[model samples]
Target chain A: MNRKKLLSGVLAVCIAAATALTSAACAKKNNKDSGGDTAEVKKLFVDLHTLMPSASENATPDQPHPVNASRYIAAAYKSLTGTEIVWASDYAKPTDNINNISAWFNQQINIKNCPAIGFTFGTKMQADGLYADLGEYLERPNPYVAGNTRWKDIFEDWVWDDPAVTDANGKIVSVPIVLHPGSATAIYYNKDMFAENGMTVPTTWNEFIKTIDDGKKVPGIKYPYVPYTGDTGISLSSWAFRYSLSPGFAAHMADRTDYDKNGIVSTNELIRAVLEGAFNPNVCQEAKALYRLAYNYYKTVLPGGWESITDTTYLNAWDEGKVAMKNQGLWYYTNEKSDVIRKFDFDLFAPPVAQSDSSAYASDLPRKKLSEGYRSQVLISFNVMLPAVSGNEKLLEKAIDFLMYLSAPEAVTAMVQENGAGLPAVKGAEYPSVYDDSAWLDREFTEIGISEWPLGFIEGNTANINAAFSDWVFGEKTEAEFFTIVNREQVNGARTMVNNMKINTAGWNI
Target chain B: MKDGKKRKIQIKYIIAAALVSVFSLFYLFDFLWAKTYKVEVVSVSDENPVASNGERVEIAVRVTHFGKPANGHVIFALPSDGRMLAFTTLTDENGVATLTYIPYTANAFLPVHDVEIRIRDQSNSIFWEINAYTDLELKMRAR
Candidate 1:
């Protein structure tokens, strides 16, 4: 009886295997008969990062939905090609740590079930050969876009040179979908609170400080000013403060550091300048004055326990009338409007300039008018990339096709409107009326384009740099102690970057 | 013959005892580890009754579980009107989550709007499948 049972089990296994093979063959034959394009590329898995809504939301037009750009873009793609988008539900959630998401994508790419299309915050993945080079494809015409000869022609010229989308080898590894034309960061203040204090929008650093001091006197306000103390890296508040002040102090270093003679300063050039002793944060009086001014301003306005506040907490405080003013990216305008329960009236203003009265280091240069040269710290938004790990040629082609469709003017406008963030990167796309404020148009005076400078060195050391600055500002460490720690870290960070990128620094007479 | 029969009986008893131990472990694991959690929406209130278009109206919600406040949970609030955007916020230590809503277009008169609120875990998974609602009046034009 045991022998017979074993034989039957073996026979069943053999029959199952045969049936699977036959079914696969039949399906392939049927696909060929029906024009196999659809069969080969039935679905594409995508992770649009923060641009798309959460899959768990199950958002639809029938209900009050957050702008579901992924759904809208998917529908348009489906109409153009008979393919479906399987939104990568398990990857790149808005709340997930960006570093973790990038690491997860790197690991997932080795598996068979990796997403065909995804996004990365930096170009490290492209450097690792994880993303497909789109240089050739960009030269091809986008069929969906009317009168477009080349796909790359649709975007702003600066986008091609932006280090975020392009790799060091000059390969286009990612597509730029959005651009921040003017000031990316601003102060969102409570209009009612300002009115009660008889305060008007401040254009100079002294006026801004006075507004904060006055707002502190109000009975209901717990924190008169809350600069976003969230992530240790370049945050909304810190970036705004650094760039707005750095121009007045560090603008003189621009001509010496911009090695390539390009209008903008690249990471390598800044690193080289640091090594050559052209710019030193440890001893330079201008640099010291910049930090001193910033420290004093933050020390005066920031409330106790401010160091513990994240973006969410600060925004919550602002919504609850606990905060009178908070620094945030322009994206918060649409974000605030979408809130169904926000009770206070609020408006945005540019970060006030540090005038000569505030500091001797401050330049008397006029604020730069709206121009293409003065771009946001985040040069590009919605950085879509095609991962090479998917390995299927047909699937990758379909992914690229869908990206082309998204790049068209109509689709780009829809996405920008839904995102409520930066302006459109593509020309001919309609500018969202929500970002029409004139305050965002005029740039800061002596606005040095290298906003991240010494503070934003190699990615690994940025957190330490930010922490040391926070410690000094919050009274945990003295100014001298803070400078000692940051100076060493910044030099080491620049050296590490130089070595990793194999930058040729022999020309520099260090 | 008696010894052989005794050995067989001993083997059968060993097998039965092992099976019983495994079953008990399974039962204990279920009872001690997988306890079910309950979430309740205590209240949803409108902070502003006389809000207008382009002006913000505050919406607040309090969540609890078995009479204890739930902290750090996420709440997604959506207005009944499909044109306006939905908002999400986190409940504080006191189990309260508040967000500000503003209408884009103005109306001639004040209109009552109902907001649908859903509570979820920090990872964004729905905890209470059922949604709660609150109503408020907005003038739809600046006063």
Candidate 2:
């Protein structure tokens, strides 16, 4: 009995010790993740690619990792996925204006070999069949985005409508990482000149133009306003001038809506009316009012010698304080510190409503409040794609899986803040104050303005449109001649757009 | 006394004396030699981040010894009578010591500045003398 009692005590002790150790281990494992045991994770072998080659590519054995933004992203990705990213520095940035990343696809680098690719807003070889039809991949539920929200639903719908991203079949071919492609025009006024002349930033459109003419009276002011007509990208005050003249043109340009059926007479319907000869230059009351407004813009507002100067010259003249007011985009003067010093501590100017009478339009323009038409169209740019060359039966899904990780809103926004020059398409991206101001992102297009999309669509591009518009501004083209040319240009694009209208059948019936 | 009895007592006394001496020497050597430690002020960019007055700023620090992460508690001695986010904090597994500093006012004159740091022993006593240098700058401008 004594031996049996002793054996029982030893057995109890051993069991207690084992139970204590198992409980301790279970506790340690539970502590590893605070959220839950629902830690579903996948391993990735495909390397993260970058737009620029890693700086350490050609290093002579004594180099640290390339200190660019991609390196940080690679580190974060490894932490998330437990995989190493391959840095291909031999594939450098676009040399001689040729994108080597795209060239690789053209070169037919095996899709299994090409992991991840990034490029700016331009020709993405979608037509060449080099790009994967990313719509299905984007539509899949993103594992990173907390719950059921698909990746496609993250960005604004209007972004995919860009004629650049949509193929002939009306499918969105790319996934954009950065949104702000081009800059919106804002007035930068010389504070010293304004203070000296007792001139304040104008609230009304007529006063704003009058201030420009009156600003020359300030000391050392030659051209009171620097309008760089030579810059083809700039539409010679088109934001304030042209957009205000006709608001909401892009929305209804190809809409199949009938007039008099609805209260809202869209800008495109009015353009269609003009095309149908409903608004002529001379005879019709509506046509005469529109013509008179265009006449006043050319005659009174435009600087006579603007067509002679180049964009660089105009900006240089502004920098020297030879001008009182200069208008440019957020990206125009990148170095804010020097721009403020050179331009006499300039301040932002709110644009006054276009002084052109909206009531004069019998269907040409919308008679709306300044607040209703105050927004600007932001150019959504940049996309990353898993090329179609990687057949789905193969590791295309794996490449796409890695892409989903890299392009997660959190991941992409971090990259934009660290590396990209413009705004992020992902929500909650904080602007680095050193590079950009948070306020410049705010602006609403009062009118549904047409993008420079057709310029990319039409064969020869926007230079022709730029030259023709410049000619009209300088009287190189007569009023009758300019109207005829612009009208013909729109009619030509309308044919192609109307056909694609079948595939993208949902939006505004256009 | 018998010879055997005397020999036994002598051996016991000798063994006791050697043990006392060995213990004294062991403690003395511990008091004499010093262990090496490494503390680095991580490189920060020119946008020396500083919060506007009435706001706060947090900075992280790392502690290491013999090329390995140094664990346990650490104390930071801030410059200009400035206080730390924590008077005392423990180092993470990676040896990162997060220390926050809030300036009542922003001074851009010297963007780069320094903070002093040291390690504490198990009993929370200062175990090491700190190496001081200008590794930090007040690059933080008034927001």
Candidate 3:
């Protein structure tokens, strides 16, 4: 009986000891998880890219006035969360090599030290599982925001529905913080030069061409229309021309090309459409007319050495009053207004619409209107994303909290006011007063129903597209020859994309 | 002998239960009661008295809380436009955070202009404002 009592006592002691040890272990873990007593402030690495000021510019205060929008954001976030943001050193310099950034991010991911927040151009990284699935978190109320039911409620429904921010599985992978009315491209004309030439802003394609023709006769104007073609990717002019004119050519093909029926044609869907014989730029009359009309317009307005001039050269020429009109993004309006040394006044107008009389393929679609409330072509900017490879759930939670703070209406207003890049994506966030004089804000935008860039189908195909277009423009390749080369390349690119993505071809009917 | 052994066993059980209770209380205390401080900004001043447009001027801000310097607190220097002039910096041991600022030329005709220097805390809940005059013509000649 004594032995039995001793055994029971021993068992009770063991159970109690185990329970105590478990509680102690959990307490230690909870402390570390909450970072309750840690003296060191946690750090989250980020790459805000062009959305932030260059470190070199900001580091050396003697340089040109630097904008510290991202710094303010970081400071605000740290104040709230006690987490410091370490920006990537090379965040300001733009690189055409998307792979380099992707590779660096992947390497960081492997080492488990990936940046918590960064920008991405497309959903490729999201598909590779590099970006965290933000759908569930977005559905939950943002803790930092007061009276917010869902985090996604901060953004407009159109922005949240954009496929660019969502993956193939319809999971939200990125947060777009800025939206601009119409496409980013606009025609910036010299106000003085326009008045001197007695030409008003063109409302139709014919009128636009005529205005350019008239501007060419002006003595000092070296190039009447200077469209930036320096980028190895699609040039500003090329993108504008193709997208603006696409509706006239391919509006009828939307039913077949827009596989998901989202109104916007995705790159994958465009490839599939080409493979399935739904859109053949070479054979289809409307498609053929698109390239021909776009090419002809370029030939008319562009100078002889237009292909050789870089964006800097074109911008310098415009500033020097040598270029009468320049095609640029809406963000340039802020830049031009802020230039202290700028001597000439400038104004912007939307790309003129193509009337039915301009071509048989023209759809006679009324020019799309632009307003603070009605944004037709919503350009998603600053797509901030979280790295999925960061296995620390606590760190992820902190990063998400920082993001929530950034997406708040007040924070977004501050960001927009500092960056002066685009309109705020979050509701209740006010845009800068600089946009008060923006004529394009109330004018009609060049309507684009189906966006198509046929010259380059794959990543490295830009060179071929540029070359072919250059040769064709320089009278080296006939229109037919240009179409043939581009058509074959398009098919190969579609095939490559299909193979790489392992895209299901079950219902493609290809 | 058995009764004595049972009493000893009962004593062991009480000790074990006491230890568990102590541990549980400790865990709860650590989880529920952690220290947090309310930080605030104290003052802002221009370190350089004479400055010109396009020349880097040093702006310093002092931050403190409850009669003590708030070390490692982040502060920002901004222009009248409310855009930050430089990246944020943490307060040093003296509770002073300094940043470099270059005044921009608003107009060539009006060479001298007043620049409003706004200092903000990490939360931007409090602000301290100061002003400095910059000569654009002098800066232009120096350049």
Candidate 4:
């Protein structure tokens, strides 16, 4: 009887001890205060490290227009948690945009005090696994939202899952903040000139050229459309190409091509096709047509001295009302209202490239109307990257919280309103109804304008095409000569891309 | 003979104690392992933080899990009067929900009004916005 009593006493004691131990372990695992965790809440001090492209002539003489979202983001976390944010902009000046590699990876990645969140065009940091894989966090519900919605549900469909942010293994490595998919290749015209000239907005290609021809006689304006060709051969080619690469014409490749089939033919796929022996530039029907279109623009449509007019020259001329219209990108509107000379109102329209005569459709060029939004390429720029660092989990969490806050509908609306640029990547964002006395760009942009260079195509494609177009447009090369130059460049560009991709040598033609 | 009988009784006691102890351990496991949750809710919108009475203010409320979305039901105890518009709504998959409320009977920029919005099980005041003309509105309510 004594033995039994002693055993019972021992069992009860063991039970009590085990219960106590389990409770301690659970307490440690739970992210709650629970009486024992008395460590006072640590205030977060996060720095936003990023770079802004140096303005050509300074968009603002005394103060830069607010382009960074960090200012609005400053309020979001403060309202919720105890966080002190430092906006550390342009940390690496020299390497800010060194051919797409930013200062964040060039110098800041190694420093212990590097900004918590950074803006970069992908670098060794991302490709070499030095950046955090944001795949998990992007999926979690955003705390900034006052409802039970996951973060994954908030982003626009195409941008949230864009292939550009993913690595070779399909792991999402970054977050895309801005997707400028609309027409960068738009005609920002002097709306006052067009209005006074009694000219209606031209919906057809033939009508557009008529206005260009008519502008020469419109009292003050000398050139109706002055594309920025200057001494830069690349600029001329780009100017001509934007009007040439319509969606109807863009699908034709130099070699057989395979796009993402996500309905977006991004630059990454173009480069991949070039390297993988899936695309070749030499015999591409689209390339030939695009070249012809550029040649035609220089021959008939471009203003004289287009060979000499740098973009700045035309922009200055536009302010003085000397130039009536110019083919530029969406970036022109992002500048401050004070930057312009303010002689006339400005409006934007897509590049008009089709032949007026239905009979002139002898080539693979599109026979469709010019106003249709057929884009040749989709431009997805300015993604936010989170670098991989050790032992700063709390700070990292806070930075992510800020990013999520920026992705909200209200935040996106503010960004579009303040920055006056950048198509919001968040769904349900509001684009300002009007821009500078003119309406906003077409929601369904008319032309998927071609880029200046065949961006991310065969390696030598950019240089070779630029030279060919320069000689052709400058009256230095004959039609035969231009064709000869282009063919040679196409061959060389493909070979360069092959070497860059490091394909093993075989029976393949170089 | 007495000692042998005592020994048998002791064995029975030990067996009974062991069974009772094992059952107690199981009970402890169940108590600690079962899931339990309490939502933390807050206002997330910085835009239109202040609104006039009778002016519909879209109140955004979020139930969070440690600053992230907490997936669960959040029932709200609405103000009894018609002033509490859209008193019940569920957070979406991202822990975000928006409801429009008419806090006053008429629209005009008036004095500030403090409204304490609550989630039924203790937590409240998830969102606070202005109700101008509060005194006049209160007079109408009193009548």
Candidate 5:
């Protein structure tokens, strides 16, 4: 009886000690002061590093409009936060790897004496556990969170859950500031060349192949079609696969698939078909086609390309009597608006959709994730983060307010008027005027629009896609061989991505 | 001989006097017979003399001859720029003229001054003018 009593006494002491330690671990920091003025809030510092294309020494003033994502985001954030933000611009840095970034972050954090929010194209820091868990902010009512009803409601219902932001891991880590939607890949033929030879837009996969083959029979033309090789080539060919595999891609992402489901059909067959259809002999056949089409189309249509050409020259071929079309994004409006090309009086339209009962039309898939261009090639693309460095509540509030402003009709109108950004994620913001001055482009989309989701932006899916594309384009792999590699890569990459992403599924009743 | 010379000079003076009298009568008839016209101007909303804050200002002008209304081009000009702002027509039968001028907010970048309306007719070589003023006093409501 005495031994039992001693054991009970020891257990009680142990319980007390455990409770004391637990309390200490869970203790909240004293964020508030007696005066209610509060503790000195630390300033959150952020660095928006972005790439800008530089002009060559002999380049004319008409260089391509460089994407200043960081600048626009910073302006909007500053307008909303009303915080005096100090910024540093890093020009022409090629390597976007997280390890390279971590070194920069460590250096900045130590020197600046502030917890830094590195506003990058991806969640490199967050995946590394260098950034805060934005999950807490999403749980509470916060405007910066993308999927919140108050905020996400402003965007189209389709975009609210664009696959770009929702990877296989189901977490949105980077915030896409500018979202370029639809496959910018379209077959642009020499209008005069096609007209002189009697050609039209191909609607079916079979027609597409036959047309290219027929074009090659012409004596003067080098190849019926040319396609980009290496990275560029793969991206273009991938679009062909993307459209063909749209239904399965959408189905699998919708969480309707089983583990045993082989969603991909004829992955290798499709790759071989695109390669054969392209009809170009060279490795970088696509880009060469673009350049050739520009020159040939210019000789007939526009008076200009007789001189050396720039990127605008490629776009002008479509407008100024060169090429009949070019596969590019809606933001190609900027390219069309270029001083020399503006005379062409261009129009916008969606690429032809392969007939599918299961695939949702592009118009139906309203929401798009703003992913980086390179990565979105393989996986989902989107933007999904808020900067944590500013630390100023007002700044954060203002940033949220700017997003709210983005939802406003006036803000959308301004963006459209400037021809600055691409599609807005908001509902009712879709209008004909958003694309071209013509009602036809708008009408075309209305007639045949399909549901679309932007790919994941933050994670390493971009690298995976690029790798897969490289193997398909340059590597000596059969169509079956290429697809096998692609599927394996997707499965392995997806698992790693989900493991890194911390998803918050609160209030998701569905 | 002197008497005969004086009589001839008197005949020449009489011929010169007759020509001057005819020219004076012609000038008087032309001035008195020229066409004259008046323009009647009013706001579209009779109940409102002043524009409701953020509302458009509607002005109407009419032209008539011998109490029968006429229809032709009417030029409306603003006092600030002295450029014709708008051109419209009077009703074919009623000769009623109307144009809307949206009032600007005090903070907005629009000229605040008197607006002028002028009407001209090719049928009678007659023209008429009218003027209206807006103070632009209040803050506008959010759009």
Candidate 6:
């Protein structure tokens, strides 16, 4: 009996020790305090791929990441909302295919529990069911929320209130977060060169081309103007198309209920004009000449390897007095900071309007006063999702509050503080103090701000535009062939994608 | 005294100490490697603001380390002035600009427009205010 009792005691002790250890190990696994577990404040991951990759680790304030605007948003969230937001530069891998970002997002962010917010180019962010309806969160009656003028009115008109656009169930799904307005399509010129050369700022299309050719003849001047067509591939083409159809394209696209409608009033007409003016070699003979002049200038005027030179290189060439005029985006100044700007004055003008008349530049002088319009990028309400598994309501609320704070007047100002670098989506938000006191405020922030366009269609057609432009640039297809391909193939492809996705196909009927 | 156990404990202590030292050294190297650069803005033009004959313009700029300029090429571009009236120039070691005139009328130049300027390198970049130095208000006076 004594031997048996001793044996039983030892077995009980062993079992108890094992049970205690197993419980302890499980507890350690559940511990949120350690970096390894998820139970503590669940970590939400954000991937900011819109910026170029940085090789640096400890990205500082002054020497902040190249995408400091995004970093500023993250930092501001931590300070204003008091939420712990951590972001890793390496969160996105090389092969993170943007096409199926919804699936990629589901895998990387583990949206079943933690909520996350981020900015991406239009194509990737629009993938299906990757977001939650932020309408209720955005419309809540907080004063700070209501006072943010930028989005208050814009949301109803452009963002959530669009009748044509609907989510998976035909409900509003994604919210506009950061908008990059189409780089305003305008003509950039050298004032000193124009004056000295007796060149009038070309107001009509004929005059503009004549002015360019005329400027080429002036003694010692390289060329009156050089569009950086060689440096920027589709961007130059996009600029060309916009200038060709600027006056009526927006309205036609905006009210485009019947996609196949004809005449100058139709979107197809505008698209056709762009196709002919840009891609139709026979029609755009003059346009092609303009493009050739631009490319030739890049080859002859720009130093060293013109093909490898960046946008800034051509811009610097302009600054160095190597070229006379460059047709480019407004960010040209913000992108290339050279003292040449001070030495020589430059100005923005609407591209000379095209006309059917032979003396287009002569009689159509009044129409020339109308400059090109700006394309807008907006900051719409960001989408925040509560994982069905982690359904942590507290975390959801915190993220919503963070967005609210970001939309606040003060916060908008803080973000816009980086002048020419960014603008806010908040409507009626006072111009940033940088602009508040300056005369250029309207031109820099207001006039240049990205305006909302037909969002869904724009997002859908981005790839088609890319492919079409690529083929046209490398001469794989003639301009007319390219246009037909873009219209019939690209736009039609987009229409098919929308139909397959069960998206509304009214405006794309053509 | 129990010599065997004592010797074993001493060995363990030495191992822990060496491990800690390695980690500290690793951290020190990373911190040193990530040191911030003292980026200074240099002029790309031979003149702070170059003069022009109303036609051709040229300018130059460079990046330097410890007062010795780096050999990398740099850019100097002009901002738009509403009328597309301005041209830009790229710079070499010392930025210089020259402009010849085609003799347009006097109303061409707008007064007091703002010029935008920017520069960048491998690690960091800088944006400068150049209107602080040059006048953008010059008008095309009829010769």
**Best-fitting candidate, measured by DockQ?**
1
Interface Cα RMSD in Å, per prediction:
9.3, 18.1, 14.3, 21.5, 16.0, 15.8
By TM-score, the best candidate is: 3
DockQ of each: 0.09, 0.02, 0.02, 0.01, 0.01, 0.06
For model 5, residues A1-510, the per-residue Cα lDDT tens digits are 699999999999999989766533322111111011242322223343432212331112133223332334445555565443333333122235444555655544443322233444344444444433333333344354445554444444343233333333334443333343433443435555676778765654335545655665665554454331111333322443445324323332322222224322122212222223221213323223332222232233222322234445454444445444444544444333322322333343344433332223211223232332111121111222233333445434433344344335434433332333344443444321323332323232211112232222233554564455445444455445544444444444433443555433232221
Give the per-residue Cα lDDT of candidate 6 at A199: 77
- lDDT string for model 5 (B23-54, tens) is 66665554342344445564444223232222
Q: Report the C-alpha lDDT of model 3 over A1-510, residue by residue, as the tens digit.
A: 699999999999999999767645643443243332233336665656556545543322243335565676777677766877766543232333455666666655454445567665545454355667787878889876689999999887776555456654455777777776465667888898888778798877767778778888889987888763433332312555655555555665666677788776666677777788655666676667767777776676566656667777777777788888777776566456544334678888876665565678666655656544454434443333454325456666665776787778766665665555577788877665445546556676655544444444554454565567668877899988877766776677667666755666778777
Expressed as tens digits, the lDDT of each residue in A1-510 for candidate 6 is 699999999999999999767645533432222123223333334443443234442323233223344455556455554545544344442333334545455554442222255443322343344455555655565444544434344332343432212232334444443333333444667778778878786654556667767766777665456554533444333444334322222332323322244211222223333322322334434333433433333344333343455666666667666566776544444333224354577666654543334221111212211123333434333455433213555545555555565556444443343223334455534332321211222342122111121212333465565566556656676666655544454345444445444554344223
How many angstroms is the interface RMSD of candidate 3? 14.3
**B38 in model 3: Cα distance from truth in Å?**
46
Candidate 4, after superposition: displacement of residue A361 in Å?
9.1
lDDT of 1: 0.60
Query: Candidate 1 falls in which docking quality class?
Result: incorrect
**Least accurate stretch of 10 residues (summed lDDT) in model 5 chain A?**
A27-36
Per-residue lDDT tens digits for candidate 2, residues A97-141, read 224445654442332233344342333344344445677777788
lDDT (0 to 1) per candidate:
0.60, 0.46, 0.60, 0.48, 0.37, 0.41
- Please say which candidate is ahead in TM-score: 4 or 5: 4
Q: Which docking band does candidate 3 fall into? A: incorrect
Distance from true location, Cα of A4 in model 4, Å: 99
Candidate 3 lDDT at A375 equals 47
Using lDDT, give the best candidate's number: 1
TM-score of chain B of each: 0.44, 0.50, 0.45, 0.40, 0.43, 0.30
